[model samples]
Target: MRVLVFALGEDDAPRVVQFARQLGAVVDVVVAASHLSSGAARIAGVGRVLAPDRPCDGSAEAVAALLASLASEYDVVAAEANSLCGDALPRAAAQLGAPMVSHVVAIEDGALLHPVQAGRAIAATRVDPLFFCTVRGDAFAAAPLGSHPAPIVPVPAPPAGDTIRLVRAAARHTDSGLTQARAVVGLGRGAANPAFSARAAALAEALGAAVAGTRPAVDAGAVPESALVGQSGRSISPDLYIALGVSGAWQHFAGVRDAKTIVAINSDAHAPIFEWADYAWVADLEGALPELLAALKR
Candidate 1:
């Protein structure tokens, strides 16, 4: 099967490469060249790279143009399941009249496998001959670097329309240190108070870690929208993940399930987060966070 994989951002390249190799297809990587180059390099092995001529940001116009450019090249299209490229995949599928699946973790038995019921249930869905799917980033390991380098090829033709320009961007700074963070500290609704946020931040700072939160905290204003960690939030798979007062709902679990190590802190010992966590600490978050911060300082 020939697969056209969309590399939405820098972080997306690794998993998309893995998926491409798994299908054993010639991979066509569609990218916004100026914004991302690693994605262009990662899938060079498959040897089909399609980049836009204009400065295409992740916009509806850009998506439309990209779809137009890539229409005839491949049989199946896959994307990194994320906000930047999420809306584009579905729209493209609808336009091409192809079957579409979103947030799929795997492809098994010749069908797409996705999580349902807030990630509590797994469902397998089969699409028609022409298929489009968005894949979860942490679901698979990136393709390993080989001894021989993959060849780089230029994409044919320029983009059709003018590039989508960003008027202004108020980039929200996240202390969750998510970009290159090796360790993460996640706070939930039980730690939604302002005082709790401060303590969580302190703990994260002391440990040189990033801070994340559950959807409830974001919805309740405990943290900024960027700090949420769940199905709707940013997906993280750090070396060490510390979940404070998080109940381990499937939505939240899916985001962090790939972490190498998990430590949970909650007052209730029976919380579901503990079941998946490597270590569970049943304690008051307010009390525990400060103590942990103090201890880590030394």
Candidate 2:
């Protein structure tokens, strides 16, 4: 099969390339960013690397146009399931009149396996040939950089008109802010109240930890969507993850599964989070938070 994999110098590129090779594909990699080095393409073990003449700063329309133009030549189009690729792939797929899938965890029996209903169940979907999709970065091992380097192919600049242009890029807190934190304090439904939310922030600050939240907390306006840690949000591997009032749903657990130590504080003994916690405490968050904060102060 002929596969075109999009790349942006992300950690997940090697893994996405490895997956393409597993399918016995003749892979062609497209570097979507402005800076191009043959080294990245060499590491991916592809024969050809296509790059734009000039670097584009996260412009979905230019990428979509490029991918749409190239879509007909390849049997499959794939990219790492990231913010940039996530937006561009769907737009490109729409241009080609092809189906698109996101958050793909695995490929089994010619079908894509991905989480559905917020990780409540796994769904296997089979798309028609010449489909576009995104693969989860953590699901596969990265391919080693090969000794041989691939040839670079430079493409012309995309047309500029009637497209949504990026004015300026703002640094996202979720990018390096939360992911780099050694300790993370995760708030859930119990932290929805203004009092509990403020306490959670104070405790996190006192403990020198980053504050994260579940989807419910984000939906309830307790925190921004960037602070959400779950299957649908940012995946982190912190040294310590303290989940407060989190029920331990699979979607939320997927993000913190690699934490060195998991500490769960929930009132319900049967809360699913307790099953995976290294330390589980059954206590009301309202009552327990103050005491915990006071003890920490002393």
Candidate 3:
């Protein structure tokens, strides 16, 4: 099979390429950034790297057009299931009159396995050979760098046309550590009080963990939306997840289902989070957090 992977110039690009290569497909990458280290392509085990003359400027339409033009030459088109590629691949599929699958976790026996019903269930789907699909980055390991670098093939910029234009871009002030951290300290509704929230942050710092929160915590203004971990928020696979005063709603669990070890600290013994936790501590977070912090320091 011939696979075209829309590279986004990060770990996601290599992740998707690794997935395609696992299927024994001949993989080619089309980088959607202005400039990227060709070494990235080499490490991804790609046959060729198709880079644009300039950066993509966050234009999904341009990417869609490029994918649409190249769709016919390849048996399958794939990308990372991220905000940018998620928008482009569907449009590209529409242009090719092909089916599209998003958030695909595994490809097995000619079927795709993906999360359904807000990640409460898994669904298997089959698509035409000539189809577009996006792979979940966390599901696949990064492709190893090879001894030889892949050839860089420059592609022309997308023509300017009637597409939504980005007037300006501003960087958001959110803790990216929550997404990249191996250890995450999660706050919930129980930690809604300013005092308790501050303690949570302190505890997180003491443990060298990134601080995150549930939707309720975000709604209560205890943390930014980027720190929210739930069905509508970012999914993560931290090595250790420490839930402080969490109720353990399914929505929240969905985000951390992949966590290797879940430790819950809540006053209520019967809290739903305890059901999913590998370790449970029944104590008030306001008091317990300080003790935990002191213990860790000692």
Q: What TM-score, computed on C-alpha atoms, does each candidate reach?
A: 0.74, 0.68, 0.75
Model 2 accuracy (lDDT, Cα):
0.77
lDDT scores in order: 0.70, 0.77, 0.77
lDDT of 3 by residue, 7-99 (tens): 654555677888898778888887765345384567646888887665554566877887887778798899866555667788989887899
RMSD from true fold, candidate 3: 4.3
**Model 1 — TM-score against the truth?**
0.74
Which residue pairs does candidate 3 place in steric collision? 34-54, 34-55, 43-145
Question: Which parts of model 1 have CA positions greater than 4 angstroms off?
Answer: 42-44, 59-65, 146-182, 190-202, 205-210, 218-228, 234-239, 245-247, 257-261, 266-285
Indicate which candidate wins on TM-score.
3
Model 1, residue 243: displacement in angstroms?
1.9
The candidate, 1 or 3, that scores higher on TM-score is 3
The lDDT, on a scale of 0 to 1, for candidate 3 is: 0.77
Q: Considering lDDT, which of the candidate structures 1 and 2 is the better prediction for this target? A: 2
Which parts of model 2 have CA positions greater than 4 angstroms off? 59-62, 161-228, 234-254, 257-261, 264-277, 280-298
